[model samples]
Target: MRDSAPLTPPVLPDRPRRAARPLLAAGLGRRDAYLLTLPLAALSLLPSWLGGPPDAFLRVALPALLAVLAGAFVALLLGRWPLERVLMGLLTGLWLGLLGRVAFVLLAPGSAPIDALALCGTWIPVLLAAHVWMLGRAAGRVASQLALGAFVLVLLVCGALHPAFALNTVGNVVMQILLASLVALGGQRSGLLRLRREVREQRLGADLTGLGDSLTGLPDGRAARRWLRQASPRRLEGLAVAVITIDQFHHVEATHGEAFAGCLMAHVARALEGALGDDDTLSRLGPSELAALLRVPDDRAARAACERLRLRVASRPLDGVNVTVSMGIAVYGGEGDGLTLLAGAQDALDDVRDAGGNRARLGEARRTVVEDMTPELRSA
Candidate 1:
């Protein structure tokens, strides 16, 4: 016997939101950052070609261009491998280091080589900040802190070795670091907001579609149709659809109130569902009709299943009233679609109602002999 408790609609659990990480907050993905390198590198070198001597410019520009091209080729080869991001970061660091050295040489030609090297070291902090903004904070935080420590060390060394040059450039270096920090923070916040909005929209869409039937707590006709459309050909083999209609459902509603009729229908749905196998699906197609999709070996098995369902419904009493269901079964013969099969089942159900209303009828070219049901057999 089935459980006597009333059926309740399924409640979907709240989906846990992922904590926003600093790494994912950055809108720029690894691939986008890698692809943007070429254009940015070209723009950075424009100053050297426009203002510096051609011989000195080529010495730096040619090597940097070759390195950029080689890095791009390697990144493309790696595709989506995890190591690709690490390789790209290394390549960017090398390129920035080269540019820093060139900048010190061109801007402070007469300064001592050691002083120029100290100034060039300032590029490390800038590179770290750029990394945080482009890829993510988690990827670059450790390196950024180390670079900052190195920057402070360089500042102290320059102060001891060449106090005048250190004093002159300290303000400029501090300003550059501050600017990079601001940019990184802004990018993270913006990306986080966009990510949150996208998650909310996805949750809303899922909630809208996941609700099934309100009364019987079973899937409705729409869900049944969707399942039929999505089911594969292998699964459809030997599949049969049975449409069950309660006999004199309108008279039951008229005699008892509408509320009692609704309760009776829910009870019938549960009884029918309990009779079906776990592999089969039962859905409420209308107020008086429910549809079952069954996997049977042949017409005999399908007929037996429908008869079992009919007996199960008639055996139970709802609010002191006996109920009996008439079923129509149609099997898939590998020719027509789900809609056609459903229509055939409905046609068979009409035939069952026409010939007294309690027995199950098989609909197809090879129809099974249906036994006649006398007025004494049907429910009141």
Candidate 2:
């Protein structure tokens, strides 16, 4: 049996976690898509003047109008307009883009009628796809079917006018339908997945919020007690608990109302946590009461820690209202369990309360009363 025993390595825990998805998705919202529109628009307009126009007026006016609409899109997006309002701006840009091409064709002196009509075959479908994408769900499907029907009618007109061009136009229209359908399908799936993820995260956050104080986000009494039981004797060789209660808490709560009192506690909790060391654990024991467990070398170190935390709380303001805290500190390793030590700290707090708070007291025993000591003696 002794020979059979062999050495084994200890199992280590996994590393810190990362987000499930760090990369941005292929489908972009209004915010991300708007950023790329200006550059794309610029490129599209760069060659507008290459071919001479039928009239100089059309050449000058069309690009300028499109530029103005681009600026409007940027303004609407930055101003945080509602979704429906922003959609209006986007649709306006597309409509202006279509009109710009029409003006260019009309102003050209040698342009044929079929050449002018070809612009519809090219630009109208694009506008319809944008409409489909923006509308989404039932509205999008209706828009898609309507667009398909309109394209078929346009194809019939082109066949009667120019049979040779109509064959190629049919292929182009078919390709547009397939491409738009694929993009819409992908975007819809990505949006649904994003919604599911957001719902799940909200539920998890709500559960975690329930396990802690709503205002301070500090672990409540139940979690605090469980942590103490696990750490007091096993993890921390020397443990000292300091119970800090806000001075005149009941009166403050009455004067300011519950909402204001909760806000004040949250500010105080942040200050207290910032002043603490890595080895110290802070929790909200109750309304207006905070509990801190300090891992220190001796009783002197614990009191010093308590004084630092008390001063930090006293110096801070709760929304322009000055506040102070009284601490009752009890050290372990002298005698008793974690709960007994917590009781001793509470008993010492009673003495501090009796002496008109804004001070601290040391716990010698469960029923023992220690004389008042100044901040100097308490720290030493």
Candidate 3:
């Protein structure tokens, strides 16, 4: 939301940095989105009868409307499509509209359809627009946009000066060639390149290995669940997520140094990792919290993994001391996304957190297996 003119149109990606209110990036290049609303811009004609048309606006508004939508359609859907090529699409589409509007006046109407000046108004707007786009910062990428625009304007001027000297055929053909060239060049630079990077960053963010905590090297529940949501349960066999917490963390900290408690957590993380398969992600969610996203082959296999991890943690020594950890497991894969899985695991964790914290509770497995792992199970 730049303080653009009213209804200037939307273009570009949303501002990724802004959390509360995202703004659309600068530029509106999609065409189908534009053509869809072409009829609406025509209604701008109504204001003409009241206040009179602005200096050559009504003539250009419809063209600009069509151009913007055409540009966006090319960019968003047709990856590898160039903004320059999209600009060409806009140029050709708007120019075609101009030809239609002009032809409508010349060969059809008994009264004057469009005066020569009004006809020139059509090309002028398109040319002026091309010139502006060429001057924008993106212009630095393709030096030829400015040149192409200049060439098209020159040809348009040649046609405007003498109809006998210029035929629409020659101008139309030249415009098409320039547009195609622009598309090949611009589409690669701005369109496809920008799109691929966004996808790559998103994939890496969900990567299981990338997001684990540095100190504990365990994963928080949010990252674990998101990773499981993306992973294939069928391929990995039995995949489950779990939340684990030490009981009465305050008492434990008071009994031992906080440094010793940290050592205990580190020991617990190391033990879980050693106990589970390599395809697991673990993190610390809070002071007393730990989460795990694990993939095994089947339900029985998942249960075995859970049991092995529990036994290992229980049997392990931390600073030559033993501290029990309660665990809650939630199976993930195609079951649901985000909170549906996480909340189930959290509910189970809360149950273990409450019922003395030395054992593992099954949420997704029981929810799927026993069919009676009710939300009330935790309270019970």
Displacement of residue 380 (Cα, Å) in model 3 is 24
Scored by lDDT, model 3 comes in at 0.55
| lDDT head-to-head 1 vs 2, winner | 1
lDDT of 2 by residue, 1-380 (tens): 00001112356999888656532554666656655565675555444444345345446655665666566567655866666556556555555545454433433445543444453435555555566556665565565566555545544554555555435644454446446645655575577657755653353222222356757767677766765565546554578888889988888889989888888888888998888876676778998888887888776677667777777877788778888888787888656577777887887787788777777667755222223444444334
Q: What's the TM-score of each model vs. the native?
A: 0.42, 0.48, 0.40
Score residue 160 of candidate 3 by CA lDDT: 67
Regions of candidate 3 where Cα sits further than 4 Å from its true position: 1-206, 219-222, 225-237, 364-380
What is the full ranking by TM-score, best candidate first?
2, 1, 3
What TM-score number comes out for model 3?
Answer: 0.40
Per TM-score, the best of the predicted structures is 2
Residues 1-380, candidate 1, lDDT per residue (tens digit)? 01011122357999999877674465766565665565575465555456445354356655666566556646655675564465555545554554445344434445344434343444544565565554555655555555545545544554555556534554355445545645554565567657755543343222223436778866778877776776667767888999999998999999998999999899999899788775677778899999998888876677777877888888898878999888888888786777778788888888888877887877854353222323232211
lDDT, residue 87, model 2: 59
The candidate 2 region of ten consecutive residues with least summed lDDT is: 1-10
Error of 2 at 200 (Å): 20
- What C-alpha RMSD separates each model from the true structure? 20.4, 15.7, 22.2
- Give the RMSD in angstroms, all C-alphas superposed, for model 2: 15.7
